[model samples]
Target: MGLKKDYAALADQDRERIQRWSVLDEGEQAAILGDLISSPEMEALVDEALAANPDLQQTLLTLRIRQVQYRKTFGDRLPEIKGGYTAGKEEDTDPSYTGSLSIGWEVDLWRKLADESRAAGKDAAQQQALYQSARDTLGAEVMKAWLELIATQKNITIEKKRLGVLEKNEAFILGRYKNGLGTLEDLDSARTRTASSRASLEEYRENLARQRRALNSLLGREAGPALTLPADYPTVVPPLISLPAQTLKRRPDLKAAYLAIEAESLRASAAYKALLPSIDLEAAFEDVADTPGAALLTDPVWSVLAGLTAPLYQGGKLRAAAEISGMETAKAYQAYRETLLDAVNEVEDAVGQEQALKKQVRHINTALASARSNRLQYREKYRAGLAGMLDLLNVQEQTYDLEQQLNNLIHERLVNRIDLGLALGLGVKQ
Candidate 1:
């Protein structure tokens, strides 16, 4: 059987809507599956999620705001200016409009401004690392959806093939019964088996359709056209890589954790520097125009001054801040180490799954071959009256089961390959 009846006759509009479905090769199908998993639509949804994903977006936005803060931290090294008008009528003072311009600059001693800037810069870098971590998570989710769709489609194909074989066998047994050469029990058993296979095929088709819809939802799209899949789906297998070399740097979560630790360390340093004294330089000018009927020129008053200030006590707030920062730094360091270990474990487990599935594939293939050979031999013997119909039926059933098992093994192999790729931080290839 093909797909469902409703899916059989493609309307002109429907067919035109999905022109790509008509010309899909196995490789193209695989590529399209990858695209559906990681399409722009899906990426856009991820961006939206990132915007609303409180924990992540908060960290990212905070990092950006901190970049501005870091730049402002250097403000202590630059001049500040103010311009305003002061107009009032006071007791014993003449009513006049006074306009004044003032400028103040803080001299950074002990590189405090430099340290704060470095800390802020580190905070921004940490945010970048967090964004990368989000990306890695989204990538893994996409890979999972893609693999599941592939598995469902493969299962449907295998079930359909078995159903076809069962129908053929049923027809043959029914013919023999009509010719009085087969028992009623043979006919009934064949019919029952055929019906059961049909029911299972339908179930597989339904499950496949459900998975397709779920994948479409993940891609941020309404269900579209039918998906075509590779005829020979590859098994999952890990590519060789130097685990020790890649674990820390290549894994996004681990990198993010490390950056977080760096950020916290820098923050701690900046906090300690907050307790020192700072110097300030100030300058100002006033320009007044008093016209006596027709004036020729105006005189302006200008002055310059410098000052320094030191903080004596603020109830130990600054010292407490430094202590808190130190604790946060230590916490970040612990988190970084934990993330590294987790990444290593994930890679090792994926590699193990790949190896185990490869062995399974070999055994399933061997079993399929033997079962097929036995089915063929038994059919011939039954036709020659050298074997009973029951013997032929049993062989056929065994062959069918083995074929399905092999199909499952093949699908498992492909899933393992995908898992390995994800573990290695590889995106789906074009």
Candidate 2:
């Protein structure tokens, strides 16, 4: 209850037109991730990762265990029946048989047992939410790896093109130097640039291979064949431009934390009740006969017993336990608040990062345009004998460097968008 009130207050604190909570549609998850990256191959990868992830499997098992525990706790609220039979013939001509049956139930006058059962049920549900959260996280990781693979492949292509241009320039400079038309210094400079370009291209290729292997590992296919990835980046339309507080409310991790608070509160209530007196009712029957069947069917001795028990004194153990549970419940509340605050920060930070990256992309685009124009002018000047080849080469290098920068920035922005969607707790449809 405290967690919900805190959430409501946090959600209402922000007042802006876009800050207004948006109503999520039935297909909202699809819309968010689909707009981020609409690729069937990526979706399949995510599904495989979720299915094969051992950690997520462990979480599912944990959830099952929690459910079983809840069942056992609920069973405690009902009467318990036990039966026994004994047969012996010691220095006797015939064997004698005895049968006994007993049932006991603690009257829940204070609803203590009910609270414990409810607490166990809530704990199970919290585990379920944790499982969902794990699934969501695994899916996001797969998609992220997929995106990085595509971006690295594209970067490799860009670096190869750069290398090719540098090689051709090196060949031309070599030709001029042999004919005494260009100085040895120019020839060496061109060769150095070509070597650096080759080195950069190799680094990109190595990075691409590493990324592919990482993706494979995430899919639990370390020995699988190389993945055939698309060369072009997927078109992304960022969803939730106007992020609503409702989106945060849907985060499974947050729900798990909130459920923890409730479960702990109930447990604290049960612990406090443990300090009070408890009433128990027990009924038992016993019979003896020549046969076990006869022992059960014949008239028997029966007793109905009722007892009231209270914690007289145990060095203040019960009181200490109650106090501990109450403290634990309070800690759960604080934990929930901390988790909620962190989630909010992550979303806001991602949104701000996306905006900053977009602006950087725009500025880089303008600079790239200007650099292209300058490169063209330098080339013309070099041909007209008004500029040295070095000047043209420098401008060309500047242009290519800007192109590389723009490529990286664009991909960085796309990755940031993916992060933003994930931070909002959007799920993949797989």
Candidate 3:
């Protein structure tokens, strides 16, 4: 099938998966949305990436070649057939014509060809798994970038608010100074804080633009139309249960590793079987006309021959090659184990991150609440002439700082939650 048709089918599958997402429980939501990489909306991005990523396209092409190789393996055991016609004329002789047909085939007495076919098939599957791994990783990164961009936009708003409050405080300080109730030092500090807020706001804007370019690149498009970020962010963290370790086994990278071992083992088997004898069956038929030194006759003739050859001394090279394949299979097995362990470690780390970030977010929330209340009090005190300009500006700065910090912590918690889902292999169906 064409990649276009395949991409459409994949997009439809994503839509179906997402359609079922709304009615699911939180845990199921995590499982389902995680596969969609945190949201149904991401389906478009992933679909575009799948169709446009050069690396992914290259993998699909390689898989196609491997499929051809697989078919050729079976073909190897089938008889090869050929047909030919030739004509020749000597100085004083009529032209002689000959036609021939031939067949040659190898009988797979040791099933080596079958083993090789299995190995080739496994290699193709391994490529598929690797492609999936790359796709999942690309999806996760795009999701993260989108989330961060949203968070940064929110931070920009906060900074703008801070700037507004600072402007108001500066005005109040100016009025107080005119009445000899504020010091020069207070005015200077107010100006400095206002400048800082403006700079931070611009910085956030710059980061936001950079992130959009990144997201566009992932979507296989140039930056033109602005990407939309969802107003609601995900916060529901799913607990890892229900044979989480088994999930690791199904991870695409791990699947690739396991398939590598299988392929290698099949190759090793084929290599071992190579030490056995091989048999070739050959048959040929020819039609002849006019011979110089023999009876000239227009006749058709046929003959068949069976040939067998046993492997003699190859100076132990074949044995060494088999041993190399065996060792590679062993290495692949160990690599699979390592991949599984790393997946487990990532899950644990994400869980740990969720625990710590939630606590930190909670604390920041409390702190943000306190800062707002304190800012209100300071505002009222300055208005009532009970507090100076310095106190009001100081509280506003504190509130501003806390708001930025709180935004960062919450964003981190959400991103880490996404990471946990990814680490658990929740981004793809088993």
Candidate 4:
């Protein structure tokens, strides 16, 4: 199957799991939420999740195993030693025992073993780089969850303020209606606006709760109270640099790609070397006894042997293997190039988004100011009986809409800032 198909399958599985848990009892849900909010083991839980998050943990374990494999491959250059004992007993025969020791080593005349070891080492390094890439991605995801939680809390606060303003306006309209200075239309419009604002407040509340749940889930827990953020969130523009070379060297994914290329290159070399002649030295010693009291050491025998292997004809299998290795090397190089291009595009996109959001924030601030002024003017005119209920309502709605837009712009700006930081691989404590 294709990569997208695999990802879709995994996502569908996760969605099913989420759906299954969503029907949990209220008390169970509360307990989970309480654990997220108050458990002192929260940090430990996060650590455990990281260690067991299937994809990441698999990469980490793969890297570790590859390192061991690489070490063992290199150890092939050292001597191999073996020792054993033999005993025999037969009817009408005394027991016999013998001990022997043997040692052998392969002489890497063409450095083929060393090259294969290098290839394995490169593979291990590539795996380590992939693990690092996974870790970086997880960190960015956590940051995104934290940011979403902050944005949701901000939305809730803004919604509350809006509801308060609507309530005050409603009270004013009610007072005017009671004094016979306002029509029922004005009171009804005010009541409707108040209800709309309250509805919006409740919507934000629900959204905030959902965002909290998602954040807590990322932390490997249930929903909890809203998290606090810095009073003034820091924003920094990413510095533009040489894209291709820098990304290839700096980005973990790109590094892994390059390492893969190196590994494939070495593997191809090793495959070609396999077609050449190889020499191995072998030595053995043995002791035998026919009786229990026999002197086995005095009856020892030793032998030394050396062998050379040259693949004269392997039914085209060796050539085919070499060809396959060459193709893999080519594929690895192409993948590396593609990864470098992707990194460059990501950096460019992040930079562009940051710039666009900054401009948007300025325009939003100007629009918000105008909206506030118009709302104030409409209120004055309505109080003086110079503006119709619809006119006042229109201005109030415009003000609220502008305020919401401004909040969204602020949130977008923050998100873009974080994205730029991620693109540059910044904001991570080394």
- Candidate 1, lDDT over the whole model: 0.62
lDDT of 2 by residue, 17-129 (tens): 22533222212233446556768888788888877877778899999999999999999999999998899887847899998999999999899999999999999999998
Q: Please list the residue runs of candidate 4 whose C-alpha ends up more than 4 Å from where it truly belongs after superposition.
A: 1-58, 174-192, 221-226, 229-248, 290-299
lDDT of each: 0.62, 0.79, 0.74, 0.67
Off by over 4 Å in 2: 1-32, 383-385
- Compared with the true structure, what per-residue lDDT tens digits does model 4 show for residues 325-382? 8788777767766665576566667666666777888888888899889888988997
The TM-scores, one per candidate, come to: 0.70, 0.89, 0.84, 0.79
Report the error of model 3 at residue 127, Å.
Answer: 1.5
Q: Return whichever of 2 and 4 wins on lDDT.
A: 2
**Residue 383 C-alpha lDDT in model 2:** 69
Clashing pairs in 1: 235-413, 235-414, 236-413, 236-414, 236-416, 236-417, 237-417
* Best model per TM-score: 2
Estimate the lDDT of model 2.
0.79
RMSD over all Cα atoms, model 2: 3.9
C-alpha positional error of residue 300 in candidate 2 after TM-score superposition, expressed in Å: 2.5
Q: RMSD in angstroms, candidate 4?
A: 11.9
Q: lDDT: which candidate is best?
A: 2
lDDT of 4: 0.67
